[model samples]
Target: MQESQSLLATARSKLEKSLLAKGLRRSGERFAILEEVYSRNDHFDAEELFQAMHQRSYPVSRATVYNTLDVLVDCGLVRRHHFGEEDNSKSRYEKSLGRQQHAHLVCTVCHRVKEFCDPRLHLIQTNVGNALQFEVESHSLVFYGQCTDDACETKPTDSSANTEDSRKTQE
Candidate 1:
């Protein structure tokens, strides 16, 4: 609990600094959105966040949510991900402060996202950068397939459905 509180304080301070630097208003609604975001561990879209704000009785507008998300992304307070081609219109976001760089495992059938970090991935990045004499600042790697969890949604068994799903996943 103490660690979580400390993290939130640091995040809040960063957001304040960013808002000031960008000449954006220091609104309580933005802070409330930050708090709501830091309170969650899942990857979520903007609509889900707006619903959560309303569920918590905050009642922020959809535009506010979207704009705040843009601010957060620009200020490095959040990380946005484009998981698949099928849902290119919807982007998922996660809090980035006090967190290490990680990769994602996405379930195509259930559309669930899981995060993982592998030291070897970092090593490989370093090795490839050295080999090609190129600077590797960062990377985004996602593995998409069916999840094994019992709660994961099952894929349609029909041949046409399978073909369509496979095509989407490959994109």
Candidate 2:
């Protein structure tokens, strides 16, 4: 918790500097959004962030949340990801403040994301970029499959049970 609070404070200071550099007036809504984003260590969507703020009576609009997210992403303070396919489509965002570049394992059925790192993968990325004569600024890699969590293992005894499990997973 102390580490996160430290990171959050650092993130806020950086955000203020970025806003100033971009010639944008600092706003409470932006700070509130930044606070929420910096507080969490997991990926979340705009609606999720907005809802969290609203639940805490932050008095921010959905549009503000979306727009602020765009600004954050533009300023390199956030990383946006489109992890799943059409039916399960959603754009998730995570703070870029104190994160190292890593890959993701996405559960297709449960939508659970796990981060992993491998030195070999980093070497491969560099080699591949060199072979293709392209400079690689960054990369997002996602491996998709069903999760091995216990909740995901239970076979549905009936259609209703399956629906309940699906709903829970989505939540």
Task: Tell me, by TM-score, which candidate is best.
Answer: 1
Regions of candidate 2 where Cα sits further than 4 Å from its true position: 87-89, 153-171
Cα lDDT of model 2 by residue, 1-171, tens digit: 898889888888888998999999799999999988987889899899999998888989999999999989988889999987565567899999778879999886667778999888889899999999999989989999877677764423468778999999999
Number of the predicted model whose lDDT against the real structure is largest? 1
What is the lDDT, from 0 to 100, of the residue 86 in candidate 2? 60
Candidate 1: C-alpha lDDT: 0.92
Clashing pairs in 2: none
**For model 2, what is the alpha-carbon lDDT of residue 49?**
97
Alpha-carbon RMSD, candidate 1: 4.5
Q: What lDDT does the true structure give each of the candidates?
A: 0.92, 0.87
Task: Tell how far residue 69 is off in model 2, in angstroms.
Answer: 0.5
As a whole number from 0 to 100, the lDDT of residue 60 in candidate 2 is 92
